[model samples]
Target: MSAVVDMPGAAHLVLADGVVHLDPEPAVLEAMLEGWALQQRTRFLNWESTIRPRIALVRRLTRFTNEYPWQWDPAEVEAFFDHLRTRRPGRPLAVSTARNYQNDLRLFFDYITDTRYGWPSMCNERFGRAPVQLLHEWNTITHTSEYEGAAERRPLAYDEVQTLFDAADGRVGEIRARRRKGSLAALRDAIVLKTVYAFGLRRQEACGLDLCDLRRNPRVADYGRFGAIFVRYGKASKGGPPKRRSVLTVPEMDWIVGVLDQYVSEVRPAFMPGKHPAFWITERRDRMSLRRLNEAFETARQAADLPPELDLHSLRHSYVTHLIEFGYPEKFVQDQVGHAYASTTAIYSHVSDEYRNRLLRRSLQARHGDLWGQET
Candidate 1:
């Protein structure tokens, strides 16, 4: 009779106490135990609370088990996977989401097989299943296998920006001087919107900035104004050698410093949750969280009569596009945006004419009158 065993240092199923124990190496056992522990810890945590947290944990588990070989009965695994596919609930799961779940399962059981327990060895050999092939079929059905396109999009046009700026300015002015103070909150809101749009900061990055991050300086220098800011890696990133604070350019520095001063001196001090590491605040004096910042952007978007779909991250996309339009190299833009791959940076290379026109002109110049009189 086969039974699962959890011995002092090793854990696996056995046919008897010592019926030829297989995969007895300590390193393998430890690795297997580690994978199990990860699963246990992940399961203990409440995954139902948030989808992001659940996805993150699932990814972590996937990474942990990716090294092991598939050990489960392939047919059993395939059946379970099919169940996951057919399981209906609220919203339909995206193809990407299903693939992610499959990846996690592959890692988990593969590690168990890599442990080389006799039962796993037997199970791996006996299981003849095509889960991976089925996953490919699912992908084909969902059309997710098509090349995921790049996201580099054009920024709002100059006219649009001007319109938004003028509208915000009027609102802020009214809020600042009004006797009834009906729209007095507009002053702080306008400052927030301008700083975000002008600087092209990530919503969280903008929300995360502290007063100390801004180096306020009155001096103007040759390389544009002399103020500076340190762009800290956001919470979404796992802190490591890759993550660090980067220096902002002059214009970005200026926007941040101006907002910092306004928030600190005029707006922040009056609010209860003002002037903390967070720069923006709500009318209730609460430090502006990213969620609040999103809401604020929506409110400002409506007030400015801008497109309803626009969000704060659009500011970052706009920033990258502006740089590209101004003829900055892909590498330079990538560095500014903290992207490691040029392909990732190229997402911002959408059909915005700023840089495209320059390249097109160069191409035309190279031809130089060759086709001037060609028949149509």
Candidate 2:
């Protein structure tokens, strides 16, 4: 047994046999690791999304090196990553994924080594060595580019988007023709896919919507009660609750008004949802889960014979691209998607070549009109 002696800035260890063990056992270090995680939470990082993954990465590093934080070195970091790369020879880790692992390790070490956190001093008093940063600029990946996502994750072309929607609608038709029991569910899935694309919502945001989130826009009275969606569960920044935004139903996507109106007035009530607030309900009268949302997108994508690489998030990308093509301002699109930076919205936009050519033609025509003092 050992006893911990708490001091002003450090903790000293005293063993049962009166011999001081400078380095504490790995099990004893769990408390300190947990404290570090808690400190991150206090700084406004989401517990489940940010802090948990950070702690998990640290634990992974520990397991790979069989060493505690104080004992770790840059060489161990390198070796651990090397092991990861070689472990799956056929499918080595992507550069972006590897970069994330390095960045997480860097942040964890930075926290532990900072004197303000008390971890370095505590480790020094107990182990005679303090935690050192194991990740450095020379060894770690540099974020030189704005986009690091997979090349395959891209916006759907206009035809591809139409095909996906048709497939979703076709599913409902197929079910109805057979008099299947799940036709209502199939139609619900179809509308969900369209809504995600129409509003450029993240999967979680879409799944987290409540019936009341839909509201009537005074200016767009013709759209009825489906004029806008108040997204209360927009993706949050580190340590913040979910962000909120109001996505107004634009004219180009007004077709969703009818679909949503029908769902709310007719289809949703059949689920026997008396008090459930979710806009999308299951047969069990529960809110749709993010997994279910993804499954719906997958079903539609496969039915349309689209690329396997395109996932539900691609719908958001398509929304951004199409909005840009429709001549909306960048800042408006940024706000619509709840992007903190316009650069993030740009990452999602993959405008079509035809749109670019159209823009070029418009510019040329305007120039010729000015030069000739007449219509070009």
Candidate 3:
């Protein structure tokens, strides 16, 4: 009924359906064993069952860990991601449950190994076998498929971002009236959205602010010149340190502080929780929800008639694009946007060919002492 092979120093298991031989090729055998160990480590933690979403979270965490061999194998890594790529939000799964099945799998296989340890494992143990083959299938199928979301990144135009901001501002006003019946609440939301664009904060970072944190920052050389908002949580947190990050720019800092002062003086006390440690308060006066902030941002974008795909995160993209358009170097833009990878900033640099040529021609004119000719 089933094919079987035996080899020295090997074990075999036979079942009604077939026989499974552990006499794998040396490379295959080593990869399998390492994968097993990684799975066991993942299972012991029970992280997906307890902490994060079911699919690919363990793998994501493991990737964050500085482990080896488990982090190295291309096939094993891909297998772990296969589980992730197949996952759908709220779907039950024995392994990988990420929303974007293809992407999760791609990331996993792109970084696995066979000869190191000490870093945490990134594979989901619940998967009986790695789904590395699935990634191959995706690449094969999508090489000519009709699926979307595979498009290259392009920065939103300046007017598009402004319109989205305006939409967000209006919705904040509507929500404030419907929920809290307050004038200042809408104004606060406007200021919050503005700050997000100006400083390119992630939703969590913006919502994680505290009144005290915004009011006081240690990094400012001239505190009076710019507004200061603390970056509390996001991609930049190192070793899970709780130390705050501060962003300062003349008008933006003043805008946030001024709105906050009004909020604290007039609105905050009315909605104050008994003793919550957050700064951005809601109608009931608690720490703002990131989801709610995102929803509000969405509503605003729609109201402003912005493209449907523009999200709160696009503010960060827009910020980077603006910086690049103004001729800031990629490295400087990367630092301002808190990107460890310059490639991320590169996506926002889709400046038009016309714009690029204009700048180039202007540079030549300035060099040749014919600046007014180009200006004319």
Show where candidate 1 strays beyond 4 Å.
1-52, 55-154, 173-185, 216-226, 235-242, 250-261, 272-275, 283-286, 362-376
CA RMSD, predictions in order: 9.0, 4.4, 10.9
lDDT scores in order: 0.54, 0.84, 0.54
Off by over 4 Å in 2: 1-24, 89-92, 124-128, 177-181, 369-376
In the range 1-376, model 2's lDDT, one tens digit per residue, is 1233342222222113345445546643675566666667668777777878878888888898888889988888899999988897667677899998898888877766666656766677767888898788899888888887777789999999999999999999999999889888888999999999999999989999998899899998999889999999998876678999999898999989888888888889888898998999998889998899999999999999999989999999999999999999999999989999998988889898899998887798787754543545
Question: How does residue 24 of candidate 1 score in lDDT?
Answer: 35
- Per-model TM-score on C-alpha atoms: 0.60, 0.88, 0.58
Score candidate 1 by TM-score against the native. Answer: 0.60
What does the lDDT read for residue 254 in candidate 2?
Answer: 94
For residues 241-312, what per-residue lDDT tens digits would candidate 1 score against the true structure? Answer: 224445455443354565546666777666666345655666665567777677666766677798755666
Candidate 1 residue-wise lDDT at 130: 16
Score residue 262 of candidate 2 by CA lDDT: 86
Q: What are the per-residue Cα lDDT tens digits for candidate 3 across 1-376?
A: 1222332111121111243335422333344334443443444533332223323443453453433333333454455555554666754332222334445444334323211221122122322233232245534223332222324334567777667666666666676667865555555566667778777777878888776665444465444323466676756332233334556553323445555565667656766555887767887767888887887676677688876656777777777777777776788777766666787678555676767888988888788877556555
Give the best candidate by TM-score.
2
